[model samples]
Target: MPSVFSALPGAVLDDSGLLHLGSPLVEQRRLAAGEAIAPLGDRAVIAVPGEDRLSWLDSLTSQALTRLDPGVGTELLVLDPQGHVEHAASVVDDGETAWLITDRGDAEGLLAWLRKMRFRLRVDPRAADDEFAVVGGTRSALARVVPATPAGRPLVWIDPWPDVSPGGYGYAAVDPHPGADRDWAEAIVTRDEERRIADAAAAGDLVLAGLTAVDALRVAAWRPRWTTDVDERALPHELDWMRTAVHLDKGCYRGQETVAKVHNLGHPPRRLVALQLDGSDSVLPVHGAAVRVGDESVGTVTSAALHYEEGPIALAIVRRSVAVDAVLTVDTSDGVISAAQEVVVPPDAGRTANIPRMPRLSRRASAQ
Candidate 1:
């Protein structure tokens, strides 16, 4: 389906239909101020409807969803047997249905996995991208334009980042986390509502931002995204994702052992960091660019953007062995740009268990 946002003036869309309406920096400021909304063409929705929806999802993912109350927003992760993140979604239940919002590129695979997991369960998971579109902005901005009870209740997924959710643990020990001020939410709207939003923007009644602006704000928030942050070896602990996505006390699910083992006995092999890049060259390093410590490669940049307040910032997944104070550089197409690291996940991020250590024996006792 064609995006209704494509009709708005100054709308420049990428192949995936994400809009960059001429001025992304300006859009970022406006969106952050709760004066604009961004059309999220890169997002997709899945609908799970059945009596067993909540319990079924709880048993399958890394969250305690069995008692997920209506209209309460949370997120979940599908981990591989090794506790590597395979899929993730922002979740919200509207009593009768559970809406799973994820990156558009991963929606089909996630939906298929959900369907395959349903063995005689009353749950039916199906793609709902054709029926709904996502609009992202502050909660108040979204409320003004989106119908609150379009589907009997608000279908907004409020981000719960930088917060240690119930049964979750905080690894980023930083004071005043970067995402503290991020008031972002994504609202699921019907096609007709999408058109209405487009019309309002076209008529100068509503201000619209673009994916570029949205991403800038997200990167500044130290928010780890599925497409940019996850790799074959990516673990929830490595990205500080356990703070929001994983319930440490949740019942057994796929990868629960690994999650417990890492949190209780071992530290994550890698850690996520926020990099303050040198803006003198005005070039943001692209994703997957190698991060270097002096002469050796230490990590790869995951997400990078030029922010409205902060000049240029990026998120990188570096080896946990890398010194926290080490000066890092990114190998971009332009040149090796220097980056000052802000720890998102510290090197000592795991081993959260309070196991008591055995008292040491004295040398005299050993002789005896």
Candidate 2:
């Protein structure tokens, strides 16, 4: 197990590499020229027919989605009263309607929550069963649809569909027939072409990972997943997932008070950090292993993975006082994995804002 994560040095780019279907995941699924791979997770398509769709949906989640474009999408988190995240969804609104892709389990809860406030409004958040699809990575099986350029590094979409949004983009799928119910709000992409693109993306070293791999990647990247990173006890700022989860300028919402107080001032009891196991061995630490700083226990490894390229890396939720650059040992079955911190939110967003200057607090928590 300790040998699982060893650094990859100069792994060559294989543009012409053989595309193998069903490699690290499911079989290579194919979609026709004008289609897409099925939408994954708990997704409910919403048709905002009345004048209040945007405002209605916006008032419920962490991000303001009234302006979500026809083609592109953005991620939003529905946080609990304690400010911890509850549900996460990527919303896509064609000119007239919107589709929220979340976990299948979360679909009904979200729908019912919105319906509870339906006091004579024109908008309706219904579960549209339209087949949906997407393509990701560099190229596509659909000759007509070109693969979008990737930013930062080599690409792979969880849905693995051709992404139309790079650095942000919006689109609308309209019907040729006038007043064809505006076909904008209630559709899913499942065309064969879309599938092919998804297939190709998955086939290449580019992985079209299932929810498990995708979730692991999210936590590793320090991006919080709704259920995993959030709960009844967490606060929003602690996760540092603000990029798309919150609107800095938006007014009051259900959990805004908690968000505001945490951001402005306060210490999040915990901090998030990445643990790079010092020694390269196959024995990986289990999820609940105690991370020790000498004799005092300061944290626990929350997520661990033998990265495709980065080796055995773990994400831990630690006490705020634990030094950001502190060296520690994680007790595992294979003796101990020497681990250290890679800056991530401790679920406490503001703790590090006033860096170096110490805050008045309790004595440190340490265990050998």
lDDT of 1 by residue, 1-368 (tens): 66777767788998667558888899999999999998899999999999999999999999999999888889999999999999999999999999999998888889999999999999999998778888999998987676435458989888888788999987876566767788998998888898888888899898999999999899888888898899999999999899899999979999999999999899999999888887463688988999999989999999988878777788999999999789899988788988878777877778752322322211112212
Q: Superposing all C-alpha atoms, what RMSD in Å does each candidate have to the true structure? A: 8.5, 13.0
Minimal lDDT window, size 10, model 2: 177-186
| Model 1 alpha-carbon miss at residue 276, Å | 0.4
Candidate 1: C-alpha lDDT: 0.86
Q: Each prediction's TM-score against the native?
A: 0.94, 0.64
lDDT of 2 at 356: 34
> Which regions of candidate 1 fall more than 4 Å away from where they truly are?
148-151, 352-368
- Model 1: residue 8 alpha-carbon error in angstroms: 2.1
TM-score of 1: 0.94
